[model samples]
Structure formats: structure tokens, C-alpha cells
Target chain A: MTLNASRQRLLGPDSLKPLNEGFEVIGAFNPGAVRVDKETVLLVRVAEKPLAVRSGFVGLPRVVSGGSVSVDWTPEVELDLRDKRVVRRKADGIARLTSLSHLRVFRRREGGSGWTPGPALLPETSAEEYGIEDPRITTIDGLHWITYVAVSRHGAATALASTTDFVAFERHGVIFPPENKDVVLFPRMIEGMHVALHRPTTRTDFCRPEIWLARSPDLLHWGQHQPILCGLNPWESERVGAGPPPIQVDEGWLVIYHGCGPSQGSEEVGAYCAGAALLDLNDPTRIVSRSVQPTMRPAVEFERNGFVPNVVFPTGLIDHGARLSVYYGAADTAVGLADLSRDELLSSLN
Target chain B: MTLNASRQRLLGPDSLKPLNEGFEVIGAFNPGAVRVDKETVLLVRVAEKPLAVRSGFVGLPRVVSGGSVSVDWTPEVELDLRDKRVVRRKADGIARLTSLSHLRVFRRREGGSGWTPGPALLPETSAEEYGIEDPRITTIDGLHWITYVAVSRHGAATALASTTDFVAFERHGVIFPPENKDVVLFPRMIEGMHVALHRPTTRTDFCRPEIWLARSPDLLHWGQHQPILCGLNPWESERVGAGPPPIQVDEGWLVIYHGCGPSQGSEEVGAYCAGAALLDLNDPTRIVSRSVQPTMRPAVEFERNGFVPNVVFPTGLIDHGARLSVYYGAADTAVGLADLSRDELLSSLN
Candidate 1:
């Protein structure tokens, strides 16, 4: 039941090899975890940047027009590079990621401690030109459907892909449009309709970013959107999003989500923490219970320092009978795992 | 054929009465025009602000939770009101519109010089809490479908409403998601499919705003999105969007669209001008011809000043056999009419 006592650092940037000889792995985190037979698979988000160095310039790697990776160089004087992960052009106030991300598979035996890396998933379309990040996997109709954020010139949109075998995959085009991310599909149909939890960011500041529920006859087109949750507590005052696919339980559908708020040390940067909420079994739009405070916070060294500091973003959850294992990205640099008793976690929510 | 010689200021804020006793109309422009039984109907967007004001505070009027108009007052010291139309909170950098908008119907009989005001359309749903602006009407079959931008905390989304007689309307919810606007539906079915031109804004600076094409079986659900036009010329270097429904002509479907570029006097604000393009009759996605330079610019005195400077946004185009009448919002403060020969406009496209 003691979360911090059972937590461990699982994987770091050094755990995976770079996609190409000219690239260097900068971060490996935010994995979409799922149990595949006897093995535990993690679709870890691998962020990479060009290894070559150029004086007084920053390089942005992206998938070019011909499906090849190219680096665009910009002068350091023209950019406001205050953030390590993003560089903003001073002229137009437009931002570009310093590194490109793609999902890489890592697996281990059910009871093994050592993990092994497998074949990687690279950016394939114009929508994924910048990169794809933060995937969540849910199984439905004997297929593992993966939902992730696709970043490009258009915007950060949620895209769907499915796989029966981890070796090969089929990509389903964008399910949610621009300014949307953090999509988690339920494992099964709810009342004969496919259900999903998505976070849509408003273009204007009239509303805060919050979690919304949507239903579809087919997974491609979604409608009947209902705003479900908003940031209420001080720890989650900024925004909230669905972390992983919800797990059905006796009480209700247990949802593990991420809540972001103002960091204690900075005004510009936000601190991301994990929280829990319970939705009604039949009607997921109705909230049964929610955690008043974050269930887990970024306290350890790995979660406090890296590409982005002071963050704990959970994107995967695995239920092992009485216990649950939560996998999260630590500081946008490494992967971290935490264990908790299912009953204790459910009881903690008010 | 000579644009400036045939242009005249049609209406201004002084033309319409305020919604209530304590409010004053600020801008009455951006009317969606259509021909109905020998009468030219204009759905004018009327923006209003609280007339009663106090020192050192600004009042923002909106439809509250209980479906009543209320004004939230904020201290002037805590806001940046450099822009006459929008006020940004200094604490969080969130911006809110200074005025609220609603669509009002205006009718002008054939051969008449004056327009008479008719029934008004008010915000009735949560999606339109902030307001509704810039409506484009297209008649197909027996009903006239009106597409407008619904602004709320959720973001600026395109909402569909249809009217049989303009006295009663049926709301069809949102057809496109957040960060999208400027939706113009085709008059009829295109190859057994309903076609539309929309402009979706990107969340990040990775891409410039451009016009896109989408098709639907029904008016409520839209899909098959394709990027059809982008800001290609210097006059349209910032963004471009479909202004009115494309008119079927001999060469192709004649499209009148709005394009924005850097203003000569200011870098912060852009100058909006109108341009023309030709799309294939069968395939609306193919660009047959386009105007290299803007066909119409903000040249007149009324178009160069007011709530928003340097704006001449065309929202309605009516074809009258050999001639066309263009109704545009000039400077976001008044309506302007421009008459052009159909043949001359088509020949102007490159």
C-alpha cells in the first residue's frame, strides 16, 4: 500500500539505442504498458535529437516530405531557448520541440527484473512528422488498440493504431482533431457503444483544459462529447487528462489520470502528478468518486531532474489481481514504476 | 469591374438597436447573405457591450449558467486592454472579448436601397456561452443550412443550424471540433456527397492556418478532411479561409476567400483582404486557378479603422446571372457592399 516504498526506476535514456547512427537518444519514458501472454510489454516513448553539433544554432529533427528524417537549423540568437525541451522563435512566438519522439517496444518476463528492447515504431505520416508521444494501449475485440499524440504542423492530435502481434501494426488515422491529446479508449464496449476519454485544449483561455467523455458506433468518428472532470484541487488547478485506459472493478471503472498544477519553485513550469477517479460502471460520464489530493507526486531524483523537471506523467497501468502496477514517465527523461494495493487505492478516493 | 468605384458602406453599428436597456451595440457586421423569394437576407452579427460603466474596471458580458446575461468586472490595472476588441489578464495571460455577439436578420427588397431589420438569433446553448460570430448560409434542397463559429471555453468550433423559413431553426450541435472556424457548405451534393470548406487553426506554430475541404453523407457528421489551400502569396502569408459558398460557374466553382498578411503600419495586427480561386467542378479539392494578388484590399477609410483595423472580411457572395454582390465586414465595425462583373472576376484569376 505504501507507494514510494515499492517504487523503482525502470528505464532511462541509456536503456534504448538510437533510431539512426546520426541520432542520439535523449529520453525514454511515458510507456504504454500491456500484458501480452507471459510477457509485459512497454511501448516506451523514445525522444532523440541529432548527435552532430553546430555552434550558435539549434537543430530540430522532423520527418521530411519524402519520409526521411531531416534537421532544420535555426540561429540561437533568434530563439528563446529557456526550456530544454522546446525552442520558441522570437519573431513569431512559435515553438518547436528540440527532440523528436517515437514509440519503442521493451519487454520482460512476468517476474523478471531485466528488460530487453525490441523493434521500434517510427514516424510514418505527415501527421507524425514532428513525432508521436504518450501512448496508451487498450484491448478490445481481441486487438490491442493504441492511442497516442501525433505532433506536426497541424497540431497535437490523437491517433489510433492497432496490433494483434507486437511485430506488426496497422495505423488508424486521427480520431480527434487539433489541440487534443491524452486519449484513452476503454477495453470494452459500454452499452453497445465504443467509449473513450479525451483531453481537448481550448484555443481561447475562456476554459481550462479538462477530461471529456465521447462515444462512437465505430471508433473512427466520435460524438456526444460530455465534459467529465476539471481541475478542482490546488495540485491540479491547471489541467487534467486521462492517463491510461480505465480498469473495471466492483466499485466502478477505476481511472488513473494525470493532473498538472503550478510548480512550487517556478511560475512558468507546471508539476504533473498522478491521481485516481471512479466513474459509474454503466454511465462513465457520472463521476462516483475522486481523489482530493494526488495519489503520487514527483519526489525522487529521477522525477525532479531531466529534459523537463518536476513531473510524473502516468500513461500505463496493469492490474495483477489484488495489486496494481503504474508505469509513468519521470521528468520526461526516464521511466518509473510504482506498486499499490488495489483496495487501498480505491479507498483513498473520496 | 472596378472594385473601388462600385463599393459603398452599407451599414454600421448605429444601424441596429441594442439587445437590452443597459447595453450598446459596438459592431454590427459580418452578415451571412442569401436570396429568399426575391429578397436579399443578411444575418448580421451584432456585438454589444454594457453601456453602464465604472471607473478603473472593465465589464465582460456573457451568458451565464442560468441562461441570463451577466457582466464580470475586472480591475483595469490587472488587464492589458491595448486591443479594443480583447482584454488580456496580466496574471494568467488569458484573453476575453470586450463585447458579446449575436446574429440578427436584415432584409432588403429587390431594387431597394435600405435594409430592414428582422428577427434576432441569440445564444441559447452552453457551446455558445461566449457568443456566435461569422455565419455562412447555403441553401440545398428545401432547407437553408447556416454554419457559424460557436465560441466557448471549449474553444471555437463550427456549429450547424438549419432553417426552413428563418423563423425557426434546428440546432445540429458541432460538426467540427476545437480550433476550427470559417465553414462554408456547398449549395448541393457533390458526387452524392455533401462538401464543405473549413479552416482549422493549428495549436502550435508548426503550420500556418489554411483552408481545408471535408465531405459528409449527412450535414451533422463530417469526415474525409483534406488540406486544399494554404497562404501562398505575400498578401495571404499569415492565413487563409473560405469566405463564402463557392458559386458554380462555367470554368469551375468560383470561391471567394479571405487572406491575411502583415499590415503596413503594424506588426502585431494583420490586414485581411479578399481573394478568388477556382476549384474543379467534380473534385473540389483540385485548384484550377488562383489570384496571385488580392482582388480586394482594405483601401477605403471605413475599412482602415474601427474596432479592428485593416480588415475587409467577405462572408457572403450572391450571384445575379451576369453580376455578383459581395457583402463584407469592414474593420469589424460596419458592413460594405461591392459589386463586380462575374466575367471580369473569373478572368482576374491566374
Candidate 2:
């Protein structure tokens, strides 16, 4: 079957308004998308920084104890600012993000082209003092469960929150603890258990960044973890993580994931590309097939250069019967979209 | 109150047998102790390494998939081996331990001075692939719950297991995820909840190593985390963690904890010392009083030099009416005991 491929930029940093007069939007990307009635809602991660950064200082923004955003300025000489996203202290080797992120809602009519931005979901708890980032949403029994990365002094942990409607949300503390991210829950329970895919980073050299499966009786308490997949091909040799909630197909579960490999021009940075995998229908933990090459790469100008270069981080996937729409973060700065025929995407995985 | 202080080495690396013919015990320390019937049971952490290392290579030991230990050899030139405990790769910057650790049982009769070594607790699950270390035991309702640091590619996570008798253990999986350790469970439930003190390390500069409180209805699922205590004084400024299960006293909960500060002679290494703190009786999260000065430091010969220098890491504490016993790992090479008057120790915290 022939495939019709369409790609475009959905939202850029310049398109969205800042949180306040003192802050500027640095990134508007990595949206978690789901269809609500007649409109498609996008929970976009908006990274913001203080508008006035001193000439000789680096301002680190965080949510303080009273739920107010605060910026702490450190002298430029004390920081190693080689990376655009992070600032590392020279003395203690401690690192902090250059900007803070919060989830903002965006919506578009079923057949409309233009999108309208709505209210933001800001950091509320101590666990999200730094930010809440890269949300992945899954609707289970009518409730849209949003899994996002909660950044705090403890580390980057996966936290869960749910909403019957996008306007009202209930926070459900942390599910997976620190040094973990990229958690995506399946749309429904598999064999009477809630299944999720997560990427837990390793401190030791024995393991690399790979996707693991966990089953929970309740979504809050996760256990029975098993390593399902790891980086195998050259394009995904460094790391791999689940992009969106897996979609059930006739053969099995279709999974879209992002893989980080060595960049073509830069040695220090990684080029993130999108790939596909299929898990067994009965047992989601067992892998059925995986793409030998990346399905999508940093081919466009928006994906090539920005706050972070050469990145196409897919975080949301929407299945529309015969077609699928993929929402991704472009170079950590703006949101981009890619649409492909469902049959063609499945055949490419094989 | 008149105080009587006595310190002595109970077990050293030379005294314990190695795990296998090819492996040699490098360190035997950091024990979790509890009273069982007429005897004191100690679960000592035993660190072991391969007997032979190539002249220009460093050996890293870890538990492989089939419950067997294996060693990987890497060129010494590619590793930064400045630290005796860790070897970091120069290219990728990933770090690994030089030795693998397992828990071994040591039994001593009441009022006895000798410790008889027994069966070892080896790494059985994938989570404990790098080995287990620093176990803390607290008995509640006739069952002894053991909280230990399970090291693997995933990082140093806290895992729980329980036993009615010390011989057989039922693994309860990981209660707290990676980059966390130093977990000590309270002997009994407070306000109908099981309380635990843990140290979850941070990847960012926002937080330092501090003791935090978490409550759970069941031991498997833990939540409601609150930061309790952090290092304040110079002698305990670098980091702090709970030593053992807190002893319930008339005034409050008396906690023994370890504090890491700058070493007297070495600028690169930290000196681990023991201190005391009192938490509010009703709310264990509130700090009542803490010691401004350490109750015990690395003053003895065994504590001053060995696998890791200038360290006296207290892992277990026992109360004997008017007297108290502090069991600690000395320089990560030997186990030492310190005796202090119960009344004097309580007064010292003020």
C-alpha cells in the first residue's frame, strides 16, 4: 500500500505568550495529545526563563515553597555553561536547568488547521519545584491519566495526575522515584493489570538507557518490572524510550519510541530520531518486531537547530483508523507533527 | 549521668571467608543488627573482588543473570581510578564499583564478645545485579523487615525483604526506586501507618543528602514523603542519613545517623561520623533536637584507614536498658562496636 506522509510545525516558542511579564517562553514542545469530543487537546511543555538575565550571571528558575516562581542568579564564572539547557557548578559539579517548564493546554477543532492555547498546569508540589515536563496522556475508563516528569532536588521522577476534563486535575504523587523518565501508560489494562513502559537511567556502567515494562494492580503502586528492550541498531545505540501510549493493532501493540544516537556533526550531542516496535498481543512484555532503522530523523530546518540541536522527540501518537498523527518536540524548542498511514507504519517495523 | 565509652573491632575482612575460590573479601562491614530471642543477629555487608587482576586492567564484579557472579576487565588507562571504591570511564564518564557486596549473617550470644559467621545472602534478582549493601533490620510483630541498598545498573535503590527467622527471606521487590538508600523502618506503626526514614540522593543542585520520612499502609507501597533532617554543623555538613531504626523513648524517637564531612587531612575524601537526633513523639517528621557535634568519629586506627579512609558509618543501634550499643563499618574494612550510656547519649543531642 502507498503511504501519504505529511509533516509541519504546530507550535513554536514565538507563538505562545509567557507566564508573566518577567518570564519569556523558551520552548513550546513535547505535547501529550488526546481527542476530547470534537477537538484534539494538546498538553504542551512550555519552558520559560527570566526575561532579564544579568550579563555576568545565570538565572535558574524554580517553584519556591509557596508555589511562586523564583530565580536564583549565580555568577557566570562559577558555572560551566557548555550546554544550552543546563548549567553545572564548577565547585560541587552540581547541575541545574537553565529554564523551568510547565504544561499548557492547546486545542484545535477536528477539521481545523489553527490551534488556540489555553490555561497552563503549573508546578504545585515540592516534588515539582524545578518543573513538570514531557507529559504523556492515556485515557483509561474515561479518565485521562497524564504521566509527566517531576523535577526537584530529589531528581527527575515520574508522577501521575488525572482529569475527567482538561480543566480540572487531581495530582497522584509520584509513581516511580528519581532518575527515571519517559513513562507511558497503556490505554487499558492488559490481563487485569495496568501496564506501563518507562526508561529508568543507570548510574553504573553495566546498563544503558532502555525501556522497561511494569505491571500495577493500581496505577500508583508499580511492581513486577522487566526489561523489555534496549538499544540494538546503530541509529539507536545510545538510548531509547517510549514516545506515546502504545496503540493496539490487529497483530499486536504498535509502539512509537525515540532513539538517541551520535549526531552527524557534533560529538557532544545526540541526534534523537523516531522508530517503531511491536509487542506481542497477549503478552505486552514480549517484543514481536522492531525497526532496523529510524522512521523519522531531523530532516527539516526546525528539527535541526534550536535550544537543543538535531532532535525529534516524539511524545504523543493519535490513531485515526487508517492514519496516525505523531506529535514531537523539535530540537527542544518547538512542537512538530508527522502523519503517516497506519498500515505503512506497521509494515515499516517489520 | 556518668558515661562509659568503649570501642573495639568485632570483625574484619581477614576474618571472613571469600564467596568463592577465585574471589577474595576486600571489606567486611556495615552491618544491620537486631535482637532475636537470646542472641544478637548481624547482617554484615561483605565486599569481594576477583583474586587476580591483569597488570594494566581493572576488574569490576557484578551478579550476572543466572545468580552467578562475573567480573569484567577494562584497561586501567581508560578508567579514572582515583577513588578506591569507584572506577569511572574516561570516555563515557560512567562509573562502576571496584567490588561487589553481599550480606552475610553473624550471630553472637547475649553478652558475648565473639561473632560466629553463618550463611550468606547472595544477589538473586536482576535489581541486585551489582550486589546488595548496608542492610538495616527492624522487627515488627515478630517479623524482621530488612531494608537494604540494592545496587545494579539502575542505581542504588532501596529494597525490602522480611523474615520470621533469619534463615529464609521473602523478597518484596523495590519499595523505593534508584538513587535512594539508607532506609530504616520504625519497629511499629505510628498513627496507623508504617514509618520509614530514607535518603534519596539528587541529580540536581537543588537538594543535598538529607533524611526524609515516608509513611505507608503496607510495606510494599510507600508514599507521603517529607524531608525531615539535613546536615547543619561542620562535622556533619556534607551529607547525612539515618543509621538504624529509631529507638522509641519517653520523650520521642531517638535516631542515630551518620554524617559525612570534610576529612581532617584529605580534601578529596569525606569523614563519616555518627550523631544523634530526637523526633517529635507524635509526628516523627518534626525534628525535636539534633547533635551539634558528632557522638563518634573516625578516631581509632581501624576507622582511619582501609578500603575507604576516615569513615565510621553506623548502620545498627541496640538499646540495653541503661546502655546502648552502636555498630558501624570502620573504614569499610571492618565492623566496630561503640558502647554509650543511654542517658548520656540522649543528653548529648541537646
Candidate 3:
């Protein structure tokens, strides 16, 4: 409720008109940001479903059915892809995801005319057998480091890759193992060590989902796993995952993340909101303060009706002198901007 | 320990020598008992694996593979069933029951020399696709009404049947739907309605495994599904299942059931223990008192080392004046008996 309901819309799924014409765009949100050469760059996660009207079958076109752009369902199969986030095939009674997601960049110079779409970065390695989604960028020295979720047969893993001019990228492979995702790296090195915050989802062995921190000299090799945040309140009883890269301030590094709780209806639906936490600048793992309640929730119509309902996912944020622009995914559909005072956010932290 | 550890052993696998000559009796425990014509009769659950062990193959024989005697694994295919209890097929990657379990009658007079083995109650209908296990008998008037767990392709359901002289049993088919087991019928109708306790294991929609109570106008039809007992303490966090039939007492129905918690090693290995509870005579769902602590845990060496590690599964209990004889499966391998005072059990229930 602290976030302003009235604000100008930023870059959304409609910005990529060329890609939207050829494909059925599901959502374009959760953009990872990095201010490169005075220009703000966003690596947005774009999801798409196959478009079929005349044919009585399920699958992507032959051109996009394999490799990096793989179709989850086979041809001549009656499958339900109603859930835009995932294309599920129920051949043997249980639904399994068969959709691929790729990252698309949106660049905007401080005072430039709106935003411009970059090339759609497809998966290159076998590790990304399914696809990559939800990129979080951290620029160290001169290189722009992007961490994203790589989904494959092995499992959902956090992958690392770097770029210089947003044109040429170097893949550093998977930094964190499977059954773990929602990784955000600290923009600057703390004590010459790269610190990261990630979420590990354990379905059987452990009962609850926990947020952990890991430090490494090299971005590819991570170690020293320690839990810094967890599901303490009923709002986050289900899970708490790290959001965008931490923002540096005079007090500390402020972080906004997403927390999910079980919905009153069915397991398919969940209540997702954005929460804030403050971490020490010298040691990113040391949590200084945290918000007992969520800063922004699903309060508007757009945030209540989409691929996933009741979701206000914060992915990118920018701070002005008096106002803060929190770029979030509204209901997992469109990109939204919420404004808050700089002092208000700093004071909200417990 | 509230119950004495020592007692004269009644019936184990040794009594079924004739059947043991050809078949392998893995476990002979969790017996359901009743007093008929001054003689105590037990419907025991006998689980058996394959006897042909010379080769490196695993399966069950034809005698125990079908009918009331059912084997979980199909013998035609080469499958790995090393887990003893479950048969896991690598094709679909699903685990099924490896050991075939069926109900067998073991009778003994008030002062008989030893226990004698009776007929093996073979599954006569298709509903008993897998096998019947863990029966609890309720004798109303002259008829002995028995309720047991029926496993089939449809799923594990609560089945109802009746017997008179332990020779002839009339199958009333399945009374409860799938995904439910551990059924125990009350001794008599409370205000003209038969009350029963059952456990239903939910897969996805619901999380916890809880024990439910239902009332029936007729034995064939049951309704009024309500959760009577659930996991309250950490020791019984995994699940709580109904064990022996609710014994009628002046205080209330003295109920002895089994509660399972995560083992010290892994979540796969659970420690099963016995606990007591008191229910209102008029309404079985209205719990009068429940024991905060377990009465009997997997303490003895016999109860610790069996087919399943650290399990003390109580299924049969006989009230003898001031003394109560508790028959339970020792370590999921054999039947072990313990004696407890009637006053001690009532005092244990809070």
C-alpha cells in the first residue's frame, strides 16, 4: 500500500512489437537492470505459447520445436496449455512443463525517447535444455554479469553469463546447482568476494523453502552456503525468494524480494507480494534490518488478473533524489512502475 | 515404559509351517482380534516376498500373486524390488507394493496350548486387487463385522466384510473410496450408527496425513467425514493412523493408535510408536482425552530391526480384566506382545 497506485507505464511486453507479431507473448516482466555507459539496460524474461487455431493438435512450429526453442508438447496430442507460464502435457495423468522461456533486453538512455528492444538471447548450451528466465544483472569493474534461471531435465539451476556491450556475451555456465533458483548477485564485490542471495526449493527432504547466501572469488565457483533469510511470518509461510540486485545506500544495501503464501482457494493459486530487507554493505550476508510486512501487494486490477494472479514481482528499481521508481511485473503480465520516497523506504525497514 | 516388555508369544510365522514350506513369510504381524464363543480369533496380515532367491531376480509366487493373495510387482518383467515393501518400476519411475499381503485367521481358546493357523482368506473380488491388510473387527450382537484396507488399481480403500465361525466370510465389497486405509470399526453402534476410524493419504491438494472418522447407517455406506486426530507434536508430525478397534470403557472408548515421526537418519525411515486416546461414547469424533506422550515406542531390539527399521506398529489389542494385551508388529517383521494395566492406559490419556 505504500507504493503509489498512479504512475506512468514503463517498458512492457508491447514494446517488442516485432517479436509479438510472430509469437504469442505470454508475459514480459522481471527485468534485470544494469546502468551501462550512462544507459539503463534490462534483460527481461519473455514467455510465449504456441498459437494454434485451425489444427487440432499441440506443439510449436517446426522452426521452434527443438534445441533452445523447444516445444513441450508433441504434435497430434491433446494437451492443456491454458496456464501461460507453463505448457503441460498430461499423457500419463500428471502435468509436466514443456515450454521454453528466453531473455530479451530493453535499453533506455537516461533522457532517451522511451526504450528500444535488443536481440532475443536464446539458449546456447545443453545446460539450458528448457530455457533461461528472470535475469538479474550485476556490473563489476567493467563487465556486466547476468544471473538467470536455467531450466532443463537436470532441474532448475542458477546460471551465470557476462556481457560487455549487450551484443557479445560470455557464458560462464551454471554457478549454482539444480533445485535452486531466484539468485541475485551483489552489484559490487564485498571484501573482494562476490556475494549472492538465492532460494533453494526442497519438496521432500526439507519442509520449508529457505533463502541462502553464498560467496565466491570467481562467479562460476560458489561456496560457503549459509541461510540469511527464511519464511518467518504467515505472509511468507510458503516461500521467500530473492528479487533484484541489492541497491547501495548510505545506510546499507536495500533489497526487495518476493514472498509467496498458500492461497485460500487451490494449490494452483498463490498470494505473491514484494518485501524489503536491508543488508550490510561490507558483508552482504549480514542482514541489518527487514520489513515485517510486505511493501507492495496485488492491489490493482492489472496485478490481480493475468497469467498468475495476485502478484506484484519487483525485478528492477531506480532511485531519484526524492522519488524511487520500482519497476515490477504486474500479475506476471505487464511491466509496472511504483513510486516511493527515498526516506519512506529507509524508514520502513524494521 | 508403561507396558511390560515380556509376555508369552502367541503366533508368529512358525505356526504356518505348512505354508512356509514353499512360500517365504516376510512378516506375520498386525493382527485384528475378537472374542467369539469364548475363543479369541485373529485376522492377521501376512506379507511374503518371493522364495526363488537362487537367481538374482526378485518377485512373488503365483499363490500369493493374485486373488485375496496379491503380489504388487508383475513377474513377467524384470523389475527391481530391493526395498522389500515397494516394487519400483523404472519405466514410469513409480514404486508399488513389492510384498503381497493377505488376511489369515489364527485362533486360540481362552486356555489353549498354543496358537493354530486357519484358512488364508484369499481376495475373492476385483476390488481387493492388491490384498487386504490390517483388519479391525467389531462384534455386534452375534455377527463379527470386519473392516480392513483394500488395495487395488483404483487405490487403497476401506473394505467391509463379516464372519461368524471364522470359516465363512461374506464380502460386502469396498465401503470407502480410494487414497484411504487403516480402517478400524467400533465395537458397537453409538446411538444406532456405526462409527469408524480411517487414515487417508493425500497426494497434492492437501499436505498433511490425517486420521478421519465417519458414521454409517449401514456397513456398506459411510459418510460424515471428519478429522478426529492429527499430528500435534513433533514426534507424530509425519502421520497418525488408527490401530486396534476402540475398546469400550467406563471413562470412554480407550483407543490405542500408531503415530509416526521422522527418523533420526532420514525422512524415508520413520519411527512408529503407539499412543492412547479417549473418545466420547456417543460421538466418536468428540475426543475426550489424548495422551501427550507415546505409550510405546520402537524400543526393543525386535521392534528396531525388521523389514522396516524402528517401527512398532500396533494393530491388535485384547482387553483382559485389569490387564490389556497389545499385539503389535515388531520392526515390521514379527508379532510382539506387551501387557498394560487398564488403569495405566486411562491415566495416560490427558
lDDT of each: 0.85, 0.85, 0.70
Task: Please provide, for model 3 over B1-350, each residue's C-alpha lDDT reduced to its tens digit, 9 standing for 90 to 100.
Answer: 24544643455555564343445777787888877777878888887665655444455432333342423336535554545565556553344565667788988887886677898776555546556777888787788888877664434556788988778898876665445567888878888877778775533212246677766666655544556788777667777888888898987888888888865754356788888889988777788988677888787777877788778778888888788888887776777778888888787777
The full ranking of all candidates by lDDT, starting with the best, is: 2, 1, 3
Better of 2 and 3 by lDDT: 2
| Candidate 3: residue A254 Cα off by (Å) | 60
Candidate 1 local lDDT, A293-342, one digit each (tens): 88888888999888888889999999996899999999999999988788
Q: Can you list each candidate's DockQ?
A: 0.41, 0.33, 0.01
Tell me the tens digit of each residue's lDDT in model 2 across A1-350. 12345778999899888985599998999999999999999999999999996999988988988789989999999988877787788987767888999999999998999899887899979889889999999999999999999987666778999998888889998877656789999988989888899887644444567788877767876666667888888878788999989999998999999899865654356889888899998899889998888888888899998889889899988889788999999999999999978888889875
lDDT of 3 at B123: 57
Question: B224-252, model 1: which lDDT tens digit per residue?
Answer: 56678888888898889999889899898
Lowest lDDT sum, 10 consecutive residues, model 3 chain A, at A61-70
Q: What's the TM for model 2?
A: 0.92
In the range B1-350, model 2's lDDT, one tens digit per residue, is 12246889999988888985699998999999998888989999999999996999988888888888888999999998877787788887777888999999999998797889987888889889889999999989999999998887766778899988788888998777656789999988999988899887755444457787877777776666667888888877778999989999888999999999865554356889888899998899889988888888888899998989889899988888788888999999999999988788889876
- All candidates' chain B TM-scores are 0.96, 0.97, 0.89
Give me the runs in candidate 3 sitting further than 4 Å from their true place.
Answer: A1-350, B5-8, B18-22, B54-56, B60-83
Q: What is the Å distance of residue A17 in model 3 from its true position?
A: 32
